[model samples]
Target: MALDIIAALVYGIITIIGGIIGYINASSNISLVSASICGLLLIFAAFARLQGQTWGLTLAAIVTAVLLVVFAFRLAKTRKFMPAGLMTILGMLTLAVMIHQFMALRR
Candidate 1:
């Protein structure tokens, strides 16, 4: 659980940084806004998990799943490994940890 929470926070920070970088490089307001919201939500989820709330990890898992798919699509389209591919891989690991933690919490 602690590990998951930490992973969630790290992932969130990475996402937020990615968004800022994306905006800086491409000037995409959409990317900045969306990523900021998503990253904040993940950070909030980590806090909730720290409070022993199962929904927190569940939220993290859902968000990670969504982002994983989106990044996967971006990777497929761009064939790039720096942002999209990297994020996709990170999201997979984060989601897996979140799911495992949630299941253990439920049991």
Candidate 2:
């Protein structure tokens, strides 16, 4: 549980930072808006996890799953491991942490 909360918080922070960078580098409002939404969702998910809400974990898991798929696809298509690969790795770790916490809760 502790690990899950910590990982979620870290992931949220990283996501927010990435969003800000994306916003700065984005060529259009659409990308900026999308990044903003993603960052906000991640922030809320982190707070929810900290509050011990099941929904928070669920939200984080869902978001991470989506990110994992996207990043994995990008990595495969580009054959690069810098950002996409790295983010995918982190997403996977976060997912694992969430699963561990959920299983412990079930027991």
Per-residue CA lDDT of model 2 for 1-107, tens digit only, reads 47877787777677666656656776556545654666567668878877878788788788778878987998999988856788889999999998998898899
Candidate 1 clash figure, as a count? 0
Off by over 4 Å in 2: 25-31
Best model per TM-score:
1
Q: Write the per-residue lDDT of candidate 1 for residues 1-107, one digit (tens) a residue.
A: 49899989999999999999999999999889989999999999999989988788888888889999999999999999989999999999998888788787779
Query: What's the TM for model 1?
Result: 0.95
lDDT of each: 0.92, 0.77
- Residue 74's lDDT within candidate 1 is 96
